[model samples]
Target chain A: MNSNTRPVADPRPAFVENPEQADQQQALGRRIITDGIRTVFLVGCGGSLAAYGPSVYTLDNRVPQLVVQAMNSDEFNYRKPAGLGPTSIVLVGSHTGTTAETVRAIDTAKAAGAESVVSLTSDPESPLATHADLAFTDRPTKWAWDPKEIAMARITQGILDAAGLAASGFDEALAALPADIPNVFADLDPALHRIAEDLATKPVTYALGSGPMEGMARAFAMFYMQEMLWRHAAAYNAGEFLHGPFEMTESQAPYLVLCGEDATRPMTDRALGFLNRYSEHVHVIDSREFRLAGVPDGVRAEIAPIVMSAVTTRLAQHLEAVLDHDLSTRRYMFSVEY
Target chain B: MNSNTRPVADPRPAFVENPEQADQQQALGRRIITDGIRTVFLVGCGGSLAAYGPSVYTLDNRVPQLVVQAMNSDEFNYRKPAGLGPTSIVLVGSHTGTTAETVRAIDTAKAAGAESVVSLTSDPESPLATHADLAFTDRPTKWAWDPKEIAMARITQGILDAAGLAASGFDEALAALPADIPNVFADLDPALHRIAEDLATKPVTYALGSGPMEGMARAFAMFYMQEMLWRHAAAYNAGEFLHGPFEMTESQAPYLVLCGEDATRPMTDRALGFLNRYSEHVHVIDSREFRLAGVPDGVRAEIAPIVMSAVTTRLAQHLEAVLDHDLSTRRYMFSVEY
Candidate 1:
């Protein structure tokens, strides 16, 4: 099922053809947004919730009528919000939908006066999905280990759409995703393979970005270095590199900066320029190089980075497997009960 | 002046008596809030900003009218927020009020049409305070190395007051802060010192929290472990521990949880309970144990954590210093150019 030599064409096949998953995701989105809930709290772990950082930024900035918080599911039930009434919505994200923390979160939300609950997952029968008022599944690819990013993006867009906000641009971006992602895989495969090979030899690697991309960089660092490669990796903001992390940048340890769109570009350039002065170890992945497969008109410019980051990350994962590193050993995993 | 053995009644004498510094911080706060500003953006570094997290949470939940972002000042200016107009107010924080990033942030906010800027600092003529429309200084006690917590709490309350909301509760909370904080220091000081000693010997340490306290956990882990101890300290949601970081928790490198007052307290307790089952190395800080020195009536229960967390952190810093750490080291300082 896993091949190191063959180039993976697309990693989302399991989700694309699975009708059950699609229905679940849509249902979850609808229940949370259209159910007359005053507040929506989304919970997940690692990439599961980190994937929603862009959406969190968007909702906080654009949606004044709705209050949204993206938190780890384990924390949801334990540190429950004070004012969550019966009209509140709680959404949990778990790729397996069986994560104990996520399940507990759903239960806690239900107990707290949350009138509606939704789950975004890859498994319809998972404990979390089974307990939710509605469930959205983005079929988990058997060959791929994690599908939380795609599931989250789809569900987050659905939530926005259900809230009466047009998500046509998001839909268009996602539509283009399947086709556009292959190109990134093609362009990044060799570089990723090279990095993976080198990662085996190096002690640490730094993943850096600015703005919303900081979360993406962190996800990559956590998923690839900590989980897949079982190596030590650090995530830093592009502007913060000079503050202290820059000292660690020598001929030995290198850094990768995810220079995605607009405001982050300049910071990326500046960091790259500064690092170039010290050593030739800094690498940048510019967002402009990739075309937005297809985005709707009037889509906020800020939203593009959300979709693009997911694509960049998926490609980075392939690099991890190609290097023949362990893909399941996580350095830090939060227990759901806590 | 530097007596390791002496039990000083007040460690923050420099701050209390420095009228010049007080004038600077007050001026900064006033300038940013009242300078015909349509929106206010707050920026700070790790400790300086962590001190302000609760206030940011309170302001966001209560005011919602003013835009507040707990961002690194460097990132704020370089990666400006979309839709920022000429009447925006930019507020920057620094212990010295002269951090390079804060200086650049103030300049950037001004360039982007900030009607007025404010600085919270310990130094009256520090670059950040000097450049502001007004600056507010907390009494320069050594214990109050980073007074931004009080400064932010007051400023946020002032904004609420100006916006026609009653701020007496917030003001009363601030008044009670001085009294309640000492007990936290007395209670946690010995434990933190011992932990610092243990951490100083270890290769890494991890700080964990959930909900609004998540930001505080990150700030503490980064500053204490990364900046002070120079050890690899990671911060994560209590829920995320099981997803990945838990894999690394052996009998050796353990995790620390900063349990703040929030909905996730039960979860944190459960997580701590579970972690104890696995390893005896886990440490927990229940923030509510310390009495708030001057809490006023009508103050929302949610706002208590913000002030309490601030007090807890000041105590943390004293321990960090005893561990032979200072953030002012050359590697930690970055030049600000705007």
Candidate 2:
């Protein structure tokens, strides 16, 4: 069967079956500290790249001792950073583990003499996982905050914990995700269905978010809408939306605003205020609205981006159902070679 | 006269007349070294924030000793990094020097006990300049790579030189800009007029670039096309464009691809190849086409983005003329408050 013709599956989170995966992630972190790694470079493509948002945001805000950077995999390989040497660790992600640039990033890291190369993907047998010094494979998932992001977040938590910068409740939050994520879907599904219906025929959709949630916005706008549905869409940082893209507000284009319970919430709030006044087709998915039972308050904001990503994924699913479009279909991706 | 009602002048560069401005920038860098500043946070809004791209890219690639970051002013203030304390310097930019969040970022920087607060703005008397510990003022210009970006680039060079990581030809290239930029306009005008006319009636235009040139892509798509022309436009990092947004290629949308003579040129080259195969309305502005007289080959790529920015600005000017839409016209910004 042609992979491009595969039917769209319902979006859902998939977890690693091996409980020792957590220990493995911790071991990776211990290796970084033990090896005297001073920098961590996160490189990936598309939604895989977006999955690093929460972890990057957390590291940027909380872990000040180490240098952290995120880049699209191809750019990472092309503009090789001067800092990515023996004192650096490269964490690369790709859902299929066959993304050409991501697989090459492992080679790039090795070429740069990085202390270690880690990969997160669903296909354990693929090139990316086979090439990396360490690989974490989870069950395949088509949604955000699933196998890849969950493992990536766990790996980041492991790194932070190893560095003595671990925040309380982070581990607890991770443990609770299995039970908590289903509740998030149940709570969000109805609203998402309504949103999908409203947005189905819109000329163009604009997704806006700030800070960590901005990644989810990009995932929804670029990956889901443009790639999956072949719909016109674009994502903008909320603060930046005010700077220029706000001109489209009065155009009455549909909008999806992801509001995470982080410090950058005010930016989305400000944009929302203007959006509500100027456009009638505005849909907001606020992370604060959902309660993840076992996740405590301190870590909620840290993990809100992941939850919001999950919501956007479910919304994309609803749009797929309503529009009768297969998410796997593509015009040029693998069908016609460039 | 209401600033909003003012006529749109032909876009051009306005520079600072003070030779001592360069000395002041070098002195600022010297202070950073003397005060043991370890982190340099570049904060701004809209085009102001985009101006820091090349400097960020350069610092990340050439000088790995310091922690360098760029963020929207609001996000910078909201998610204040734990690292932003006594050993940090905050460089903020705003064209009018009165952007609310940029002014607030100065307070945020001061409250965090940063070593110094630097403001780059056209208005010396504005609150941002008035409150910042050090302010650099330049002549007002409504375009990319003009007063703000030039000053920011100079400041970056100063920091690099102070840290003994100075690359040869950077200063020589800076010195050549005044004479070189007008030639860029002359060189690009005919092609740009055609591009502007071709793009004027398009429902949406997409801009793509890689590495240093990506900043110019964003400035053109967001600041120029969206804000100034009130048109729908979006920018994609050329490498990332393949990840998802490339799905729009066959839609026959007009695309503006900026190619610079940099390591990441191949990323854009790959995208341009795919674009050429898939789309008919692809317009490319390659920096290698322009001979920046005094800028040696070593530093040409570093300054290529600035030149590409000038070309895009010229393109926007032609767009404004062809569309019969005043670039200064705005529906909501400063008109009806949110």
Candidate 3:
């Protein structure tokens, strides 16, 4: 089932060679703290937004004194947060460096008097990166998410250190990712294929995850299940699933619960317990089942989404196998032009 | 078409008579600011989460000195934010005051050494109200939402006053709701039926809105459309809609776009521009179309969700008419144990 589209190898990040930009970002982080900056807005769209999921999940724990808000790029362009001007920094990311909403958000942030506008994109020549006050570029790849994860970890640690919270930083934990990320694909789970086979026949599918893993589950449901396979699917936060969306659960309802190592495991376990009673096809992708010996326990809790992403990527591949649907097929994405 | 189960009469809130609780809530709000509270956690689940939409939308615009984070009750219970205890007040509201997750969260906040636990619920006997350090109760209603809005406005204004930012408060503006709210149903919208009829047959529907109205659109799609009619519908914030859900849009795909008059209108309008190209069955519930003459221009931009909710209530009734299905019809709600 492996095709040319499948990311077959681990791609190196371009930023590794460009240490100057990394230093500048760290300096910007220190400046924010020194200037008494009250807010740090992390803005992006789609996969770019999901890229920051881990940082969003872990930043507060590392720097409780800092206020961080993750904003959808377009939302930030319109609903400019109060005091977002000279007192704040707008950190944005786009893969192609051509995501219109993100480019516009950078312009909007500058106009709103933001002290700094920083961007992360794959294409250095792309407007999203070229027009920013500070921009970091990486070579684009469909399957490689480690670059973004590393970039975010660096930025997060910078801010944490500037806030005098280096003792609680995640630098060492993130450094272990280069080795651990590759190991996620070394051993394949056959249950991933069985889950895909069950979901291929179901018209609607739901994904559930706790804390950091929630965003990864959402990306799988939307990007893989819906966009890749053209299946009706959506992801809900574990706690939210216990609220109204749980009503949709029925006998044989297809559900993929991403159980990661986190403080919220009890909540996800509770949700899974209830889901077990309702659906025969309820499948669990528990990180506990995996042997991620390269990653430390402390970092394991935060990077659960990255691990889930690696597993779901396999599920997406297997879905292509059983459904006989090409992962590249699309009616509207790049075809008819929506 | 209105039946016995329908709430045809306008239910006035009991808060008008019970001003003491409101006064106490105001004092708590001020104390939160005066005591140098660094974090304000707004927590709830389901409709109660939507109830805080406007405050969540407009609070930062008015009170830049304070930090506000809206959290799901269950999520808060497990993944407690780093700065949640001692210096933070968990402001929670539950209509029935007996939701287990929210009740558990109240206990969690107290256990975490929260400076204050303030609650707003209708059932005084419920543990949520009884166990709170300060609790405000309103008489229950099936359709009315003004009491919560008024209460939030008062609490928000008190916090603003303490922070020396009360000049931008909307207390008087929200007071106009009891008068303006009744007028929403005085004249029904014909477009509501047209939208409902077009949506009745679709297997899946999407609702999009910005800011406060985002929550309203979500409630209309999930609670009203899915829960009441057993139709598949979901809502996305305008910016979020552009990210991934837009991939689902196709020719004739039914969409209900809630165009509210707020700072985020441009964002929603941008999304609508793209949705218009993809779906012919796009429907707009523009607050600008309403004659909300009683609502002041200043506050009209803030309460678009409340206005949209009024029209959506009408749409719910019309959907029952078009589908020949009762709004109360449910496969398992209250009838089956989960």
Candidate 2 on A20-121: residue-level lDDT in tens?
Answer: 887788777666666677889999988888888888888788766777888999889988897889899999998889999999999899998998898988
For model 3, chain A alone compared with the true chain A gives a TM-score of: 0.87
* Model 2 clash tally, residue pairs: 0
Best by TM-score: 2
**TM-scores for candidates 1 onward, in order:** 0.76, 0.94, 0.89
Query: Candidate 1, residues A6-76: lDDT per residue as tens digits?
Result: 45334443236354555566556566667666566778886678767776656654454555667666655
Give the poorly placed runs of model 2, Cα more than 4 Å off.
Answer: A1-13, A30-36, A140-145, B1-11, B30-35, B140-145
| Per-residue lDDT over B1-338 for candidate 1, one digit per residue giving the tens place of the 0 to 100 score | 12252231233321243445434444444555566554567787656666667666665555534555567766676656643557666778887776777888877877777676777777777888788877775534545534666566556655666556545566555555566556566776777655555555565566777666676677766664566445565677666755655555566666677776655566567668767877767766677665555665456354556544554355445545655455344442453331
Native-to-model Cα distance after best TM-score fit, residue A203 in candidate 1, in Å: 3.6
Q: Rate the local accuracy (lDDT) of all candidates.
A: 0.62, 0.83, 0.74
TM-score of chain A of each: 0.80, 0.93, 0.87
B132-232: candidate 2 lDDT, tens digit per residue: 98888875443445677677677778778877887799878888887887787777788988898889868888899999888889889899999988888
In model 1, what lDDT does residue A300 have?
35
The candidate that wins on DockQ is 2
- DockQ comparisons of all candidates to the true complex: 0.29, 0.73, 0.47
Could you give the CAPRI-style class of model 2? medium
User: Backbone collision count in every prediction?
Assistant: 51, 0, 1
- Best-matching candidate per lDDT: 2
The sequence of per-residue lDDT tens digits that candidate 3 reaches over residues A1-338 is 22333332232222242567567666777777888877788898877887788778777655676778887887787777775877888888988777778999888888988888888887788998889888877664434554666677677767777877654425555555556655665555467767877897787788898788888888887777766677778787887766567776778778899998878888789888888887898988888866666666666676566667667777777777777777667655545432
